[model samples]
Target: MSRALFAYPKQAQFGRVLPKNKIYEHTSPSPALKALFVQQIDQIVWQYKLAPETINLPAKPAVPEIQIFDITLKTAELDHDVLRCIDKAIPFPIIFQLSHDNRIQTIATYKRPSEADNNKWVIDGYFADDWQPIETPRQPLPVALDLQGLYEQLLRRLLPLPPREQEALKNHVERLAQWHGKHNEYQKLQAKLNKEKQFNRKVEINAQLRRLKTELEQLS
Candidate 1:
């Protein structure tokens, strides 16, 4: 059941600071803000050309934007890819971290837990569990360009897709859109597509997805 896992647009830049509570409470949210954010996620994917997975799913919208990472561990000698993830790190607290190379080095600077965070888990706070790996996002390409190229990937068609297929896809995409790159995006998405165990479709979809993201980057 291994499948491709690509969330909409990649998560915000690896170490960028997220806005505070007062921000989301704004009276008028930016139009296409979601679209623009998704586009950024897509750009990160294209930039890295990753397949997607559970570990790097930083786009979890619920996760805060800013965080620190620690790269002090080493990938097992048994890892298949040595050059995977640029480093072994993720932003601390809510923000997630992704590495391009598995050889990533884990930094040891960790934040000390505070009594306030322990008492008020309601607000965003750092936790040791935050280090656990998560499922990668599963974002697919729109149908229009899916048939052709990135120039016209029509997201509309995906709306009324054939039966449960569309429903499942929509649900998954919504959840995945929350984070950035995948810890192992490829493995997750491959298990979910066309009932086949593969990944090129993700590549094809990502190619198209990236094209749309370029315009958004300019705005961000």
Candidate 2:
């Protein structure tokens, strides 16, 4: 019989689930519970026809368990609600079998000690095959970032730069941040322009648009 999946807390005790009222407190899972979850995840991998090698299951029950799921090509574009459901159901780190452009990639999402602050959770990397670490650091929880920002930071870290080049890159990043702020302003102006039917008000908006466009061009 298939076992029910449990939503384990990140800092929970090793063996068993904490009481619902005290869920946020740090605790660990028991050895038996860890083994059972690992077995259940393994069974799911088999049922989905996903390669077991893509998953980086711990060699021993002593290690923290991570939930694994094989996302097939057909289901690669899973809707937001479905993805949210999956995320809610799984307690441990999640490994995804992602298919894109006829290529199968193993993407793992595991929590790591936050560099900026220790008492927070951060999804550090998207590991490749054999759990090879990918440097994709993200912001801490509660104030999460969009995937675009995450991938942008990943791409930025792909190569090392010289001292002077690093300085230039830092300036460029600052400029990009400014551009994003201006972009938000531009969007708001466009929205206001769209709703305002009065000719005089439209003329004022058009002037503001021209100035914002000029600033954006300077940034570019």
Which candidate should be chosen as best, given TM-score against the real structure?
Answer: 2
Candidate 1 deviates by what RMSD?
20.9
lDDT of 1 by residue, 7-110 (tens): 33444224333332222243233445433333332212212211124223322222222232222222222121111121112222221233333322111111
- Predicted structure with the largest lDDT when compared to the true one: 2
For residue 122, model 1's alpha carbon misses the true position, in angstroms, by 9.6
TM-score of 2: 0.34
Error of 1 at 140 (Å): 7.4
* Native-to-model Cα distance after best TM-score fit, residue 46 in candidate 2, in Å: 15
Find the 10 residues in a row with the least total lDDT in model 1.
80-89
What does the lDDT read for residue 157 in candidate 1? 25
- Per-residue lDDT of model 2, residues 115-216, tens digit only: 676544444323343222233232231111332222233323321221223444335455656777898999999999999999999999999999999998
